[model samples]
Each structure stands twice: as structure tokens, then as C-alpha cells.
Target: MPKKLPEVILYTDGACRGNPGPGGWGALLIWNGKEKEIAGGNPQTTNNRMEMKAIIEGLKTLKRPCHVKIHSDSALIVNTFTKGWIDNWIKRGWKKSDKKPVENRDLWEEMLRAAQPHKLSWFKVKGHSDDELNNRVDALAVAESKKF
Candidate 1:
């Protein structure tokens, strides 16, 4: 029989002081009843970039291929993969319907690479609600943004 892959649950969030200002990303990884948290920030960036950064960083932390379910408050992040925005973007050579270059293509490409090794599913969690882990990562992101 084939071995079952391990399972991981990841929660992520991002925060920015302004549309294009200091920004931060946070992630929490849970596996085998343990947890790992990571966060970082950029002096100047957009909230979308930070949101992508959180997922990218979290996925990069896994040691090998696994089943990973990612939870995020940002609809952009969740829907990009879940609703097939990424597939169309790739089909269109990273251009939107209006032929504009996709914003944060660099991170999207990097995230694609980071995620290739795992089987992933995306979930959307309401931001700033009663979801404990989501709220925790949100706090982490907000704190990290305050540093810059």
C-alpha cells in the first residue's frame, strides 16, 4: 500500500501601515500536534505583497512533500489559487484580462515554486474574528509591521 502523506495546517496573515508602506507577514504551521510560527517585514511594500509573502514563507518551511491546507484572511490569496486566477494568469503569460502584467508576479512565481512539492488546498477565514489561530497570526503580522 502507498504511504499516506503527512498533513499540515498553516495559517497566515499580513499587515501594512499604508497602501505602499511598511508591511509585515506572519504564518503559523501546525503538524503532529506541534506548532511553528514565523514572521517578517519589509520597509516598503503593499498588503497584497505581504499576504503573498506569508504563504510563501510558510510553505517554504516544510521539509518534504505533504498535504497542506492553507488558511488566510485575504481573499486575494485564497481566491488566487482556489478560484483558478493563477491558472488563467499562467495561461495568459502572467497578464490580466486587460493585458496588464500581474502585480507581484515575482512572489507568485516564487510561491508557485515553494508550493510545488506539496498537495495544497486553500481556505478563507474571516479576519479579526473568533478564529484563534487566524487571530494569532494577525497579531503577529500587525506587530511585525509596527517594527518598521
Candidate 2:
């Protein structure tokens, strides 16, 4: 058998009934033509946490380092990487520009750690748009959140 490529594609979405109410996260990971779906919910959490959790869970599933491209509708998630906010936050001891502590610091730390083993690229997609994978994940997240 031919060796599989070390390239993975991930689509993630999060949904919450209220800003700090029940929430859920969904992720779809594709590698070498294989698909894996992962999801979870929190009884009391923010949308941002669910968003971060989606990507974190996806990355955590990788057994080995790979080149990963993550697609997310959350600007907070996309810009954090594409705009180099993660690096700055780390350099500033997890503080934003105004020296205030970053929100979701715990989740951010876990996400950073989960992503460290992989070479990652972040992409921003229009939420609830025509993207099939993105839409599917969004629906999944909504359904999961409703369970709580």
C-alpha cells in the first residue's frame, strides 16, 4: 500500500443557545480520504470556548504531526492565527495589547498545546454560508447544544 500523505483538512463550528449558556462544538477531520467527526458540549460555557474546543478536539485526534489546514467561521479563531495574535499573546504573557489578560486563557493554552505538534494553517469561511462542510458542522453543533 502507498503511504498516506501527512496532510489533513479540518472544519469546525460551535453553537450556543445563550452567550454563556449550553454550548456545543463540532469538528470534521479529513486525512488521506478518511473522515472523522468529533463533537462535545458544555452545560455552561461561552460560544468562544466551544469554538476553541472544536479545533482543540480536532487537533488532539492526530496521532502524529501533520500539515493541517483548519477552516472556521469564527473571526476570533481565524484571526488569532492568521493575524499572529497567538504569538503576541504568548509573548505578552497571555495579555492583550492593553495588558489585560486574554479571555479564554485556559482554552487558548490547551488549543496552543494541541496544535503545537502539527504544522497548521488557518482559514476563515463564511458562517452559515454555502460551504457544505461548514454547514454540516454548524448543524451538528446546534443539535449537540440542544441536548444540554
Q: Which numbered prediction scores highest in TM-score against the true structure?
A: 1
- The local distance difference test score of each candidate is 0.94, 0.93
lDDT of candidate 2 over 42-85, digit per residue (tens): 99999999999999999999999898999999999899998999
Stretches of model 2 off by over 4 angstroms after superposition: 1-5
User: What are the TM-scores, per candidate, against the unseen true structure?
Assistant: 0.97, 0.94
Model 1, span 62-138: residue lDDT tens: 99999999999999878888889999999999998899999999999999999999999889999999999999999
What C-alpha RMSD separates each model from the true structure? 0.8, 2.6
Clashing pairs in 1: none
**What TM-score quantifies how close candidate 1 is to the native fold?**
0.97
